[model samples]
Target: PALHRQRHQFVIDFVKQHKPKKVVDLGCSECSLLKKLRFHREIELLVGLDVNGAKVKKHMYGLAPISTDYLQPTYDQLCIELYQGSVTQEDARLRGFDLVTAIELIEHLTLADVGLFSAVLFGYMTPVAVIVSTPNSEFNPLLPGLRGFRHSDHKFEWTRAEFRSWALKVCLDYGYEVAFTGVGQAPQGQQESVGFCSQIGVFHRIGGRNGCNMLLDDDADDVFSYTLLYSIKY
Candidate 1:
């Protein structure tokens, strides 16, 4: 309930914040964000994907038209487009959108697929923004007996430092500029799992710094946050 409500709010707020022409929500479970985006009068398109078809069906009552193994467009912006697929392995064919989002994704994929996954994702961008998130490695409950952090399906999580280092490389390798980065929210009094990252990244495409690999700008914000980074990279 809280997750869906928050997702709805996030979509509403994000649409207002960026006013993107097109948006993609990778690893979108049940299209919560996409469904919430329905009220955005300015949104021209919304696409969502999930690795599991059952989850997609559970979330989307009418998305049965998308019968392909991966994706088949279901609707225009006014009618949320949902797909059953994997962000890590599925083709990131969404090209040149004003925004692309991967909420609670990344850590679910094998570490080996991280780079290729990102590369595929970055390939379709038309010099715009990307919003991505994953679990923090410091607090993942995957340890035995739930001693610390644990997740049933997580492949790998990254610490703040680890996330930053990878983020820096992602910017350089993919021609994006970092604008902001931070952690996601946690319940009051309950320490949030940093080891189980709930990170967010916002990026935009740009040229390298005089022919060298483009590094995250020093001005990039690693400011105060709670379960979401709101990082803006170009």
Candidate 2:
């Protein structure tokens, strides 16, 4: 399943609002997000980094068919670059894209390295905006003793508050004001519920010289009106 699809409106709103020239999808597995932006050719460059470069190269040929459908003209012709490198140690200097997304990738990192990882991203790229989504620890049934996300690799899952605290502290240390938001909106939903609710956070880097200043303070702006099991923005 493509997570980018789950948050398509956010991406559209984010793009139409910010209009970043370059984009980097960190921990990008199949570069699914890049394929979706095929219609917007003027976005300039796209660089995707993962820990396994060979994996990206292999998928390029495998996804060739998927591209022909919507992401036509092929990525090689679209000026998209995919490489295998860890978001934790990846050199984003030349990869300083307008927007960066690490959806569902945060919980895979060690609790201590996450903040450091974000710092590394800012230190080199300093993108005007960033989007991060992780499983809200409050809902992580495997946490406290079961390990993070029930993944053999994930180091930790973060509560809404914990995610935002890390977001604020990291950006502040790097000289930027940050605004957070839930990824999956519920404002227009028909009813309120928990098992059906999802969590996410958007971190906008302020005064960076590019990207738009987008913030959402409407507490009722979620996928539901009032869900006791879900959490508030941090």
Candidate 3:
């Protein structure tokens, strides 16, 4: 649970540093991270997408601005939205965002779906930066009574070397460079050997920002597969 908080904080710190106006969270079940992100004054547009429409709809109202928000308005406007869809599908609304995050989400998909996700996010959406976090299989042995992957739904968890190898190939296929870091240190003696409980990859596009030009594009070919569930403008 502490590591989960750290994952959110890690993205928050990134927003503070980069001040990305448009951000989206892929596989944002329950909209928890989106709720946390709504408070940042720098973000103009915040979007969350998940395949489970009912789950997202159930918690999305909590993201609405409170009475205090209306009484004491900020200078910048924030448009928050939730959508129901698979991450492997391309949506016109998601393209060209300043930041994209997939927190503890990749491991849930099968290997084939993972390939589709890479192509959709890195190739189609092409955000300026992307943050992805997944459990480190190497650390599973340390958890008491834990047998297989952390979640029963997780198709496959990658060991440190396996994760790095996949990330490196993603960077190469897409024009981005990646840096690896993580939260949840191992026990003092085994820290060096097991690495973090959750591993993260931060990716930045190469060649002077390739996706900005299409930020406001209205091309007919652009697709909108995700169903809009809720939206609020402030």
Candidate order by decreasing lDDT: 3, 1, 2
TM per candidate? 0.68, 0.69, 0.96
> What is candidate 2's lDDT per residue for 109-158, written digit by digit as tens?
87667766876766545677777777664544422475436567767756
lDDT by residue (1-60, candidate 1, tens digit) is: 454355346546767987876777877776667656644646666667676767766766
**Which residue pairs clash in candidate 3?**
none
Local distance difference test, per candidate?
Answer: 0.58, 0.58, 0.90
Error of 1 at 133 (Å): 1.4
Positional deviation of residue 12's Cα in model 2 after best superposition, in angstroms? 3.6
The sequence of per-residue lDDT tens digits that candidate 3 reaches over residues 1-234 is: 687899999999999999999999998998889989988879999999999999998999999888788775554888998999999898888988899999999999999999999999988888999999999988999999998778999999998899999899998898888999998989889978999999999999886365344544767787889999999997
**Prediction 3 global C-alpha lDDT:** 0.90
Top candidate (TM-score):
3
Scored against the true structure, residue 156 in model 1 reaches a CA lDDT of: 68
For every candidate in turn, the CA RMSD to the true structure comes to 11.4, 12.8, 1.6
TM-score order of candidates, top first: 3, 2, 1
Error of 1 at 128 (Å): 1.0
